[model samples]
Target: MTTVPRSLDEIIASADALADRFEAYEPADADRDSVDPTTALWLAASRRAAAERDLAAAVVEARRAGVPWKVVGELVGTSGEAARQRYGRHAAR
Candidate 1:
């Protein structure tokens, strides 16, 4: 199977799934500072998923509009080279 998802919707769905999984596994501690390592990892994973979804959507829209990957990377605060390295494979499929 391809590592890249087919659409923005799929990316968002993956993010939602990560968020749900985080919620399901989160510790019910009253103090936010008291979260354990596992819980913290879940939180981080949830955040990463959300960020990935947003970035994927932007890349998809930009590609559809004929915006170059380098320009898109610059807009996102990364090198054009890096953006292509990270997202180009997805666009290919």
Candidate 2:
């Protein structure tokens, strides 16, 4: 069977689903099987890192397009100073 590639959001969602499943799981044979929580945690970390990178790239693009830090902050749901503090250096490059 051919497998389709999943987007970052989809991957994150799948990871969340797996976490929920694992959380509710009970092993019928404890000597034979186990559920690993680290997989979900790693997936969550990967998703967070990917999102941060994408946000930085968008910030750079917005700065290049002459978008104000205040506007960027509004779009990102933060104060202008906070947004600038977080992304100004990346946007500079």
Candidate 3:
């Protein structure tokens, strides 16, 4: 079996940068209907941000699925107690 690569903060940062770049470089005529390229880029960046959120949620779910807090925290660059305080509430419901 292969383990999937998961880096929530990195993914989120990348997505935000992409979105910011797309917005910054958008053409002046990139209104709701003028040119389609900017619109497409905007959509793609939005999708990336959404995907990042989904992945973070999945990581949280994986923790809820009985994966150890220490391991999850290590993967996310935090301590087990930190992970518990930050994410344990999700598993409460």
Candidate 4:
């Protein structure tokens, strides 16, 4: 969609209005120490990574302990060959 560009006067007026609003703004309880979206996402990603690593370690243990890929596949909701294809290399380790 093409936007009609604002005139210089309109732009200045909008900027001045924003500046005035910013200058007049006061902090409320809701604005203090709220959850930051970026930080929250970073924390969630970190947790997900840690969980993935833990799952891999457990899979390696199961593989080494002679757990069949059929059992693993049932638990993980995939085919036995699929599970083997994904994690069979770790079996020797």
Q: Whole-model Cα lDDT per candidate?
A: 0.85, 0.90, 0.76, 0.82
Best by TM-score: 2
Q: What range of 10 consecutive residues in model 3 has the weakest lDDT sum?
A: 26-35
How does model 1 score by TM-score? 0.56
The sequence of per-residue lDDT tens digits that candidate 3 reaches over residues 1-93 is: 844436998778778987999988855554645658887899899999997677568667877688898887887789978877877776465
True-vs-predicted CA distance for residue 46, candidate 4, Å = 0.9
- Compute each candidate's TM-score over C-alphas: 0.56, 0.62, 0.40, 0.57
Best by lDDT: 2
Give residue 75's lDDT in candidate 4 (0 to 100).
Answer: 77
| Model 1 ranges off by over 4 Å | 1-33
Count clashing residue pairs in model 1: 0
Clashing residue pairs in candidate 2 are none
Instruction: Give the higher-lDDT candidate: 1 or 4.
Output: 1
Model 1 scores a C-alpha lDDT of 0.85
lDDT tens digits, residues 1-93, model 2? 834438988788878988999999876797345447897689789999999999999999999999999999999999989999999999999
lDDT of 1 by residue, 2-68 (tens): 4666799999988898899988885556775687999899999999999998888778888888999
